[model samples]
Target chain A: MFAKRHVISMREFSREEIDSVLDLAESLEPYARGGGCDALSGKILALLFFEPSTRTRLSFETAMMRLGGKTLSLGPTEGSAMAKGESLADTIRVIGAYADALVIRHPKEGSARLASQFSPVPVLNAGDGAGHHPTQTLLDLYTIRKESRLEDLRIALVGDLKYGRTVHSLAYALALYGADITLVSPQTLEMPDRIKADLAGKGTMVRETHALEDVLGEVDVLYITRIQKERFPDPYEYQKVAKSYRIGAESLAGARDRLIIMHPLPRVDEIAPEVDETRHAVYFRQSFYGVPVRMALLKMLIGDRLE
Target chain B: MNDGEMKLRVTPIGNGTVIDHIPAGQALNVLKILGIDRTTQATISLLMNVSSRRSGRKDIVKVEDRELKEEEVNKISLIAPGATINIIRDRRVVDKYTVDMPDLIVGVLRCPNPSCISNTNEPINSRFIVKSKNPVILRCVYCEQAIAENIADYLI
Candidate 1:
């Protein structure tokens, strides 16, 4: 049962738990498509965004609304008490008193976990600074399963592997399903050693390379992430790797027809506009899946069905 | 004097504790962990960089009329994983045991990350999971940031 549980990391979920969530999401797909459900009628969710996130924030709010639950939103911290030097724990403690569950996004790593320690209700991580985003991972998993089979598929995660928290959490979730993962990134933005070690420890097949062309034909899924300019300590370093890996339509010539391309949105140039017309492009549909996936998550966390 | 005959000796305490086999140059860190400074009333003897047969060089701390608490011993293990704690009673070693590194450490050290919640105005204690013992790698339970060096500076 997921009642009162804090979803801080994808690593915290077992294969069975992930399956349960996916199953719940599948069952709630019709309900998310304008059907009615009062599973969370009296429940109130708190949305605390210390950072700017349009899609994630909107999806979570929409998810709660679809479930007949109301939301209390605290937008960007600039106008909030946090900018006035309020602590995350203090904010969570105060908000936790009012809501049935809390969804938090912060610019600092571990902010979600830190809030969870003081929150009386379940805390869902929207995104943390270069840290885990469990809900995003959950939605990504749902998309992958819907588009392609989950097990034993060759998946290539391309772009800024070092700073993309989405790739980090997704990699861990894919590892749970025994997916063969090829991490494609510039040398400067390669996956961290700790993550590689963890994948190896889990007996997950992992391959690292700088070029996407090498694994294009073999992959069943191409998960792309933007090479963020903000995560760099040196602007010069960011400029060097900015255009290193671009996936245009021409680049997908050798790729499998069944290959599903996905990206956590707000993409700049990492994914080409022409790729949007290709059959492989499922990233747009992927964004829509966030609603039902998050609705399932919220329901499981608050409703008596999963209890 | 011959190398074997040049043993440095400190007067034994009537009743207290002896922490031996500490890695060389960590005696001060041990004192910091024990909250021992110039203002302390207890009689304390610290021997640093002393030659030892077990290890090439070691540090030791002897405190009079004070036995280390279990929590204090755990903290010392973070800095000196190989240290041996010996309880002295009536000038005799009554109990002796080497420190065992704990799997989880809570509220003992500050997280080095300035952005960590533990560093904020929030009322939360720092928590770390011991990832390695030999080099003393501590991964913050919240942020998953690994702290490998300058651990003494983070001690609470």
Candidate 2:
């Protein structure tokens, strides 16, 4: 049913669509765990990464391979036609001819949507610079559902709310499920006013705080993100808030027993290593869920079976 | 009679459009938006710093033989929300309507984001949903990037 549909923004999805993807991801767990599936035997998935990524790129490739689909990848701008000054539209139009679908990760905001406009096939946004990442939102939803109840839970999204595209997408998606959201970030890195207004329009309960400790015990899910050093135009500002909201074992002492810690990884010092052993730690498992979730998306988008 | 009481009325156009009540100092932006500066044939008159009871200071533009489209009026509202659009026919004002802020705008203004897909070589037209009217906040439909000030810089 999702054939040829571009997944550029989580804002475009309804609650039912989010649920369907989560349900499909749950069903495809075994298949993602390496159980055989040839739903896309001859399909070719093209991956275009204009920015550095580890889990997102790897999971998408793994998802395609697990679905018996082949992949063609263009990694880093240095070696690609981009290095030769090829336009994003030209690259997308050219690659759209060779692949059945495209997954693009660009450093520029809205580049994925731009790519999708030129691409003939469905274009899934891996991550866009300070913009929406629909697939990551899907996997995060799947992870949230798996770890804790998705509806009516307190979710505190901590660190770099201004620039974290993942948190931006997640906040919008969580609003759909009527989740009470507490945004934790430095004063300089608060969530954008428009996003807060959007959440308010949706009747989503949103509160902002600078300290993770203030809301750690109250939230069911502590969604953590690194303070992206590259997003800052000023190095001094980055250094000022680099370690402002860290989560260690000491910080988790007052947290709920069922509190699930989730992070879109390549984490810096925002999360301590000691927090990794706690029962609250599910970030790695959350990362593992990305494969099945992406496989579900690919299947829904390109596979023969709609259900 | 004193110059103030002399009633200096702008000469009426036989058939054209008049944009009135534009915020003072923004007539140039209105001209740029309507492409009046580039139009070589049309007879255009621009009145700046005119007195107005409603806004105190206003600007006006009269374009001969040109009736503005709905989209053009909406674009004008982005820069001058309280401006009025007047259609003149046979030297008489036929229809006059205040420009209302549009909910959605298409292909009039370029997105401020340098990396926005609309800025790229893609054939996509930039689209925005008006979020606020007084200050004129435009949120890009594709990128969700909000532009609040200096919107004239992004006018297409």
Candidate 3:
């Protein structure tokens, strides 16, 4: 078997591979409940983030610590040889020599892919521009499975699907397992046609709706995403679309008891804070479980023997 | 014969291959596309910055003892979509090959979309379903980002 060397995008994993990770995460809940540390003792994880982050960087660091491993966090784009004009290839080559494994975040569209090409170690993408985030999608999948059943589930993705890298990656993983996906957003914020066509090709039920209320009672999983200001050029455009897509308990009154609300966080109001109190609120758990799921991910990635 | 020894005479293509009306400035894009840039395997003759009756200034590459296949003709259509190709057999022109728009291209143009699904990790090969040919539009099989005609490149 080829070494599982890179995780630049979620689209790289097959349905079977994703299922395997979910199964590992299922068992990981015990570790989470028991509060054990040292699953990956003494291992070193290199976090090379050129862009600013909140949830992803901290989540991976927490995952490493909980596993009894060490982490080396590099600050955003300022401190490294990057400021001195070292090429991305040279940076990865130098980093690969020191770190056992590498996690990278860069502003270039294919930065993770480029890192994987040069780095000798496993290169995990923390986030790549307005592109894909494979690990985030994995936790999101695990969250959906834990909060509610995943197979054939009705999943409605709301907010900025056009610029939401999380939604783009998540929608494909949802389709890989055969979910009925309803993409609800403003016309300009609508799901890109490429993803729509892919779902259509797979015969996955997809609909574009302007109002979330129309689909509120109908969906099993309300996967909400925020308008990423960083993904847009103009702040004014971001401000205009931000108001229309908030998820609160008022909208959830008609939703199913089994319903789950999720967002790739550091949210800017697409999801109301009040929704976090509801039983349907799984975003925090989703965000929290990222630590353990990623623990399993890093362990699986680095080939550590697990009992 | 290879290298300079394998050269195409400047004489008018007596009834053979009609590499008609190549863009004078870009005969090199066509030559590079044909995999001739570094090869010393064949005798090469090129006409550059020449006046084309069809295109204002033109570039041409006439390779001796080389014939393009049907699939290759399709590729020629893409690189210089306006350029023409001709068949040469026994020093005689047999059939003229005209450039045509491609509906589903196998492997020539690269998808221009940086966020395209084919640009991702899954073990699956990349694919683009053609939406239009005129202003070529392609929908990536994975991410579903539609890359415009020139910006998106497609492969088999």
Best by TM-score: 1
Candidate 1 ranges beyond 4 A from true positions: A1-4, A229-244, A305-307, B1-9, B153-156
lDDT of each: 0.86, 0.85, 0.72
Q: Considering TM-score, which of the candidate structures 1 and 3 is the better prediction for this target?
A: 1
- Tell me the deviation in Å of residue A11 in model 2: 1.3
Instruction: Report candidate 1's fraction of native contacts.
Output: 0.73
Q: What is the DockQ of candidate 2?
A: 0.48
Task: Enumerate the candidates' DockQ scores in order.
Answer: 0.66, 0.48, 0.12
Question: Model 3 misses residue B22 by how many Å?
Answer: 7.3
What is the C-alpha lDDT profile of model 2 across A68-182, one tens digit per residue? Answer: 9899999668988888878888899999999989999887788887887788888899888767788888888998999998978899998888867678789988999999999
- Which residue pairs in model 2 clash with each other? none
Candidate 3 TM-score versus the reference: 0.74
Summed backbone clashes in each candidate are: 0, 0, 19
Report the C-alpha displacement of residue B42, candidate 3, in angstroms: 11
- For residues A100-193, what per-residue lDDT tens digits would candidate 3 score against the true structure? 7899887756667767877888889887777778899999988888888788789899888887868878888888888888888877778877
Candidate 1 Cα deviation (angstroms), residue A302 = 1.4
Per-residue CA lDDT of model 1 for B1-156, tens digit only, reads 245454435666889999999999999988887788999999998988888888989999999899887666867888888899999999899999999888888777888877666676667778899988877788998888889898878888
Q: DockQ winner among the candidates? A: 1
**Of candidates 2 and 1, the better by lDDT:** 1
Candidate of highest lDDT? 1
